[model samples]
Target: MAQARRELAERLREGGSESAALEARVLMEAVAGERDPDPFGRLDPDATARLEAFAARRLSGEPVFRIIGEREFWGLPFALSKATLEPRPDSETLVEAALDCIGDRRQEPFSVLDLGTGTGCLLISVLSECRAATGLGVDLSPDACETAQHNAVVNSVSERVSFVQGSWTTALDRRFDLILSNPPYIPTAEIATLDVSVRDHDPMLALDGGADGLAPYRIFARTLPDVLAPQGIVVLEIGAGQEQDVIALMTQGGFAWRGSRRDLGGHPRALIFGYALK
Candidate 1:
């Protein structure tokens, strides 16, 4: 095991991986099907083959989570698919802000609607905390819906959640106490300029936000109010420098800006909103 780790780290280092050693350790454990595997143990032929393949994929710019087919968000495991975006730590800001907004209502039987749900991380995480809350996750990709459903089951929240393939809130007929979304916010042209890890690996449908990157926000502005309960709150993840634009769009839709939350990096990442009259 020590030999394999050293060799993989060396290869990844040569391939320009900044965190080669950590990647090596993670990949090794993944191949062994355990966390922190025995350092003295040797890999079987199958494990060795799998490690080599995984190494090559990593060298080709696939993210570690993509290779492993899962990622941890809000301390819960969520499976990923070709059609879904890998839930990032920045997105946790949305969950935190949403929960903060829900505050005293956390114990209530609130309903949550997560649009562009992807891996269902936001909805599932929220439901995990609000035991009495039920959620519906909506994604445009069938594969994403299936993957999210599986994640809900893995996290033991399947009974409280349902996944559907649809565009935004089109499939919904009822209002929700909370609505969350981390829609694609990258401008169409800027996508090509993103780092290879993101540009090459994440699904484009989960990244592109049309010409100005505010297309999804526009859709939300036009449709969100209809699905928000009288006292409902909406928390959305926005790209850098997008707070004002998104707030304006939501305001045009009759949503009043509540406030915003910053991610660990201190970027304005989560925007909160509620109906203007309420």
Candidate 2:
């Protein structure tokens, strides 16, 4: 099994996978159906065959997360569906920023709204931490909404979370204490330049952000303020180098700019702002 893992990693490395070793381990674990067991002892003929097939898919440029159909965000395992975007480490920046902004209100029944919610990762993860919170996740794609609902169930957050398929801020007419989103931000022209894992595997509707990658932000700036409660906080995942432009756009749309958080790569990834204090 170890030899198989190494062979798979080598093939991935040759294919330019940055985390070949890590992906190999994750894939093997899935095939092994065990956590950190003796890989050599864990292998059966059937498992070995599955590993080879998984390795072949990986070599062909399918992301390990997609092949495994799962991802980890904020220490929780989230299952991925074809309609949902994989929960990425960078998106965790938004979660951390939201948690920090809501530090003292963790036990309160603070309401949350997640826009363009794919996999419902943002809202569901937050609800997992904020035990008393209730959340609503919104997305235009029906399939994504269903997947997110399923994720909520698997995470045991269904009791506190609900999902709906509708345009941003249109399906509901209520105020929320917090709003979060990791909306599509890649520029239309730049979508073609993304890696195969994103350009081809990820849905174009989830990747394209109009001509300048600011279209969704523009929409947020226009619509979000109407549904935010007094002192309500807003956390958004921004594309790299989009800090000032996004801040300016939100400011024009009437949100008070608070600040932003940087990701591990030192990029301004999560922007934070809020309504005027009550």
Candidate 3:
């Protein structure tokens, strides 16, 4: 059994399914009470069965994060469920832009509003940086709200971050110092054409950006101004080539162009806008 397990692990690696080996190792360790296994010793029968099931799912294109039910974002591990979209590294740009906009303003207790806050990763990360900050994360899905709340507690920022379920900023009663969003910006028609990992796994509500792929931007531009404090900033993650159109929508809705930022590949990935002039 020991030698057979070693052969299985090596074959999985050779088949270009490296995660299978790691998953098997973890399961065997749990079953055998060895943090680091010796000679790939015997795995509990039940544990081996579970590993096989997980491997089947993984091999069929399920994300590791989904299978494991956790993902690391901004150096924090967040619990994930089907209700929330998987947090991606690109969204970190929104966090960075928000912090930069709040520079040296720590004296004032600022309120942050995160639209479409999935898993609370963005809001939690920001609140972690600005101890004086309090955040409200809103999502349309109740499951997402629950997931976000769980993440807040996990990150030890439950007192500073609150999760609400709603569409847009309709439920917000007070103006916020900062409002940021990485809403669905993928064009409706283009969604099906995306890679299998994205198309099959990610939630459609988080991906469909409407016919023009700029609908959410238009809505945010219209509604955020009302909820944003005077001179406050709003940063949005945009789809590729949608920057100009998004800026136009912001202008029409009375926002000022504060400038744009690019992702690691130099594409215009995030847009920063200032609240309308009084």
TM-score of each: 0.98, 0.96, 0.87
Ranking by lDDT: 1, 2, 3
The number of residue pairs in model 3 that clash at the backbone is: 0
Off by over 4 Å in 1: none
lDDT assessment of candidate 3: 0.82
Off by over 4 Å in 3: 1-42, 106-108, 276-278
Better of 2 and 3 by TM-score: 2
How good is model 3 by TM-score?
Answer: 0.87
lDDT of 1: 0.94
lDDT of each: 0.94, 0.89, 0.82
TM-score of 1: 0.98
Tens-digit lDDT track of model 2 for 38-117: 85575788988999899888888788989989898889888888788888898999989999999988998899999999
lDDT of 3 by residue, 1-278 (tens): 46545655665566466575665555445445556767635656776676676556656667656776777889998988887889888888888888888899854689989999988888899898888899999999999999999999988899988898999988678999888898999988899899666788888888999998998988987788789998788989998999899999999999998988887777888789996567
What tens digits encode model 1's per-residue C-alpha lDDT throughout 1-278?
A: 99999999999999999999999998998999999999999999999999999999999999988999989999999998899999999999999999899888888898999999999999999999999999999999999999999999999999999998899988678999999999999999999999898999899999999999999999999999789999899999999899999999999999999999999999999999999984
Worst 10 residues of 3 by lDDT: 24-33
Clashes of each: 0, 0, 0
